[model samples]
Target: MMISYADSALSVLPPLLAITLAIFTRKVLLSLGVGILLGALLLTDFSMIGSGEYLANTVSQLVWKDAALNSWNVYILGFLIVLGMITALITVSGSARAFADWAKLHIRNKRDAKLMTMFLGCVVFIDDYFNSLVVGSISRPITDRYHISRAKLAYILDSTAAPVCVISPVSSWGAYIIALIGGILTAHGFADAGHLSVFVQMIPMNFYAVFSLLLLLCVAAFSLDVGPMRQHELNALRGNLFDETKGQPPGATTDLPEADTGKVIGLFLPIAILVFATVYFMVSSGADSLAASELPFSVLGAFENTDVSSSLFFGSLVGFIATVGLAIQQKVEWSMLVKGMVVGARSMLPAIYILLFAWTIASVIGQLETGKYMASLATDNIPFALLPAVLFVLAGVTAFSTGTSWGTFGIMLPIAADMAMGSDSSMMLPMLAAVLSGAVFGDHCSPISDTTILSSTGASCHHIDHVVTQLPYALITAFISIVGYTVLGFTGSLMAGLISCSVLFVISIVILHFWAKK
Candidate 1:
């Protein structure tokens, strides 16, 4: 059923209910389920049978889209499971422990641990999912050895993932946004504008992304742990990496068997292969897509057309095979190999459940036209000088409510372009950039976000703990971004906006330092 409640105010209720309940109750699955049920009921006009059918169809689409078994959601879920199994095999082969022991020699303090993790997060900017899980896999041992909290590690992963991806033109986010910008420009008669150049131009205007990364570095360099993050840091320093009361997080497999001897090569080789293979596949997939289209082949064009879900799955499968090969080469018991794969698959069940629920609810919200409703409210009767600022806030709220930045980008970008045309054509870039920045900001804070959930899973931290601790930092960056976008809107100077954000960020850092001392 293709239904839209875009004109109805009730369109906003389901997501609001879910987000509010998740934050307050800290019961993510229950909250999402309730929201999904309520949205389905609303869509079906409160008919129980209709609602059930709606939900079943939505869930079924996760694996079957267009009556095909191959779906992006299925590929992503498969990647997670394969990656989990690789992680387990690495553990069983003793590669992870050996790598950790090697890291301990060089990462001598908590600060180094933090910075290393941040650096890794930034370097792996091809995709947020890749960044979150792989960086967590690589950095967890070092951070844990230094008594860094999983919450803090997850915060680093979360911050670095989307912010970096949003700004980096080579990333999946970059490719997607560039493609959107291309269509929007064509629609507005800027068909001659180079999409890549346009994306690069807006990079600085993406104040939320630029500043969120700056804030992440500041958090690491100055130990600027505020809000819930402060307590999490303190607890970590006191030898508690996670809240035992919350139980083991997804991917925290304690009963997995380990070999008596292992090599660091076991860890590095698989990760390197995974990263390289994934990138290669991404480019190859993009090339394949370009070949089928009328567009000329270019590296940027390739990325803009790539199938990221399939690439991740292929890459993880290769990595899993490498891990298994290494385990066998190490004379790891066959029984241990079987146990590791089984345990690894089991470890991802919680995350899989959450992903399924989150994906389904997101579909329901789409049916309800929640983002469309929110976008409508902000695009009307807005002053030209406030367009960028207004769009930033609007995009943030839309993404936060929808729990999907890409969806927000799709909903808001054309709307932003249309609004900009009515005001000032030159303001288009700033407005579009604001939408991107705000979407990333909202995604960072949204509990139902896949990146947020994966960041928690990667660090094996309580999901709610990661969400709560990361919110303050995301909010601070968002506030600075609002100011920056406002300056850009009024002055039409991207530099002015950049300066405004830079000054505010420094001021915020100083305040954080003094407050932490107090």
Candidate 2:
């Protein structure tokens, strides 16, 4: 049986220390590393790390093995590397430049450039990791030509990645969420309402995801800026994407390896193949699962049965093959292709390291059972009408502290499902929506979060700048989400709550824009 630490208040300390240090120091990597170290010490019952014999042993066992050497941890790192290579291949082939030129005719102004970035972000919903890197690389040139701030560009990339995936039922995110919810249902001996169906029902109720995209649209279309983003935008208007007199940092130096012939096809076709393959593999996996289970045929049924991690890896691999094959067809030599892949992988090395630390700290926190400890606090006595909002805060804090949305999902989905099955059953869908929305919102802001780091890397912006500029926007949407969840929890009216939240999002943004640089 799995160990439980639901009553242990010490469980939350590791992640809390990480969050506090990250915000205080603005050094995410160091903060995470120290947090993991502190967690290890705590795990040893507050043993001193500087003491004689235990130091090397603690560093090797906890930091290296327990955190980094885990299998799934390696796969996630590998996924980022492969995705980086694909983006690099696209850039090295001149596909990104060609796309930018093609976009020039249709994109005549800053709004057009921003809109294109926003549109691409929404369209590339296969995986959040893919979306951030691919969209940033492809859209940055256009945004740069129009003097759009890298901060804004990063915002567009960051906002779209997680929000789009959660709502996109065809994404790896969807499959993972389905499996999580389904596993919970099965554990509780209540599996009739398929995870996919429940997920679909909760879609409209996902206030943060839905509104985050909308807020991105508003920011793009209206040039809305607030807080630190306002300063960034104003600097961009003066041709300073960064607020430094050092001028813009030079971008990657990779020569085009292919002729401009079929540039659009070379760029977009490969992306489409990747998306289609990912969806195909996911659906295929789901279908196979359904067949083995002898379940009734339904679209949602297939999704609930899907294997997300396997499908993500499979789809990305196929996409890599397709992209390389497309490059050869376009007369690109194998040497240049290999070079591009290397360059791309190298570029992603920093991000991969950050992920390594993030996964490690999150693993340490998991070992501490932080989520269960928090969930234990959410007992049946809490009013159902307040549960969704409360759970949203809890999930958000948990995700922010741990810096892993997937980990948050794994922890919260089962707890939310159980709570729904308990006395306060009316809040199931709302609570479900709350958990999903909160995870994305928190992950969006956390400096150590993989998606947050990827968004900055993808946009080629300074990582801290991305984190600094985007947090206010994420918090605004999250505030709207909390209010929306509260309404939903109370009345169980998805439409009313969503509408109120939507209106609040627009109005609050507009008001903030006025308060910002115009």
The lDDT of each candidate is 0.89, 0.77
lDDT of 2: 0.77
The runs of at least 3 residues in candidate 1 whose Cα sits more than 4 Å from the true structure, single-residue gaps closed, are 1-3
Candidate 1 global Cα RMSD: 1.3
Give the per-residue lDDT of model 2 (tens digit) for 1-518. Answer: 12344578877777778777877776767888788887666666655643223435433443357546644445555656677677777766677778778878888999989988889998888778778876787788789888899889999999999999998776778867887777776787767876667778889888889988888888888877888888888889898876454322213324435445437677788777777887787678888988888877666566666665566667767878887888788777678888888876777677766666776676677767887787667777888788889888888887887777888898888788778878566667688789999999889988878888888877877677888899888999999999988888777788878877977987898787787654
Going through the candidates in order, what is the number of backbone clashes in each?
A: 0, 0
Tell me the TM-score of model 2: 0.85
- Candidate 2: how large is its RMSD? 4.2
All candidates: TM-score? 0.98, 0.85
In model 2, the runs with Cα more than 4 Å from the true position are 1-6, 48-71, 183-191, 242-262, 283-318, 321-338, 379-381, 421-424
Worst-scoring 10-residue span by lDDT in model 1: 378-387
Name the lDDT of candidate 1: 0.89
